[model samples]
Target: MTNTDVGITDDEGSTMTLGEGRTPLIPSTHDENLYYKHEGLNPSGSFKDRGTALTVSKALEEGIEKLHVCSSGNAALSLAVYTRRAGLECVCHVPEQTSESKKQLMEALGATLVEYDGVYEDIFHELREKDLDGWNVTPGVSNTSLEAYERIAAEILAQVVPEQVIVPCGNGTNLAGIWRGFEKHGESPAMVGVQMKGAAPIKKALEEEKSHAVVEDPGESLAEGIIASESFNCAEATDAITASDGRLEVITETELEAGLRELVREGILPEPTSAAVKPVADRYDGVTVAVVTGSGLKNYTELRELC
Candidate 1:
């Protein structure tokens, strides 16, 4: 299939575009059978671009003037760039304690940053009660986000057919979408979702065979992208993992550090969150493809320390 044939079409001829999707799938220098999906090369330097590209287009299609999201970082950055490109307004609701630099980056990307107090999830929940005018750009809350990530699987399939697809899973929306996409094409690859140890509620839930689990007082993690009190689409994500015969793997800080160094040495600088997949990918035989979720340049503060 052509790139257009596999990617999400600008259904109504929406103009919002950043050349999102069509990321290269390159074979890993470290492992002959392993390939890395260079998602960090996207305009916003993360996989969120695949989803944001579509979400912002939908907003334009509906004549929506504003959008809002609750994000710690990448999602907001993605939304900010896409929404700005689409001539729309985006407001990011971030934790009050979020770093000034992070908040400033969102603003720099053209998003209006709003600070929220109390539990991160609870604050968003309360905002939901407002019945806001714009779309909730949270990964799971947006149907477009889930549908958007399906395009990644399509892009990956067009490049190579691996025996397994590994994701550096955060809220699991991306993982759920990959399962949906592969299933749509009648391909069954063992999906592997990797997470940082402390904030791994999805891993815990899978072990318990439950719909979901909440991480109480999640420990400090090097992978800030995946930290969460509870994943927004836990049930859907859990169902996807179970149905695909996939299991969750948790990574500790030490392994995460090694993985970060390995990827960088191999000439790919990935954010710590994306590097969490290294150990998991190493364990699998056959053709395995791991999604490199974001750029280490954006997380230079932590990346510098880790290196």
Candidate 2:
């Protein structure tokens, strides 16, 4: 969990110091030799830290102070913590239904939380209308987040060298970042994307061979982090998947919940979003690592009740 823990060798034979990049890739208790990249162990308790650190570091370099972002949970909390750490202020606009634990985490990190009575996209629309004097808005996936997430692919390439990388897709930044990282590092692993059955925008877009915005589902699942009413980069994410020769699939809530239980029984406490990687674990025959994207601590009570 420190800089000295992981190795990085550049193409020019030069090396940049590694961040807290190498997380434990432990074997799954249920499956034979399958492994899980325990992203819950990340500094921010989610894989978002890898990118948020890069983004906030850049923001600091740019002399930005106050920042704003909208999210259902993980990304907002991650950015909030990083911003606080960087001595900058962050205003997180979250949906009213966002977990209390996540809200508490944000508050404890010294970020202001603005709870709106609608979906994240709605809050995003509201934010767009606001006149910000100098505060930078974390452009969800299309901005620095995309570049930050690239590290996930780099870590996977070094550790597992899997035939395929399965991630729970939401904003598409993680998929795009990971894909670009693997491509840049000359490590081309097949990238499989997983989404909730009801909110499978990427899968629907692939099947229809057209980019269509996903309508919000009224029904709920534990994978709250991946529920976006509409996605701006769905096409781009799909393109990345197709280019990598990977497929995107939808896993039912029942399957994801079962995965959550399995993870807990194995002592890998993961958020519901993290658990979505479970159903798709069986697809790839070779080495496969599912990104456990958030800590159960972010939603301990709910995750425990589900168990």
Winning candidate number (lDDT): 1
lDDT tens string, model 2, 62-137?
7878877878888789888877767888988899899898999899999889899887777777787788654545
TM-score of 1: 0.92
- So what's the TM-score on candidate 2? 0.89
Per-model lDDT: 0.81, 0.76
Native-referenced Cα lDDT, model 1: 0.81
Which digits, one per residue and each the tens of the lDDT, describe model 1 over residues 1-307? 5656555454523357788777888889878999999899999888888788878877888889999888767888888888887789999988775545567778887888888775566655777777887777777677677776777788887877889989987788888988898888778888898877778889888878888788887755667777666777777788888888888888788888899988888888898889988888988999999999888878887767777
- Model 2 scores a C-alpha lDDT of 0.76
List ranges where model 2 is wrong by over 4 Å: 1-19, 139-142, 216-218
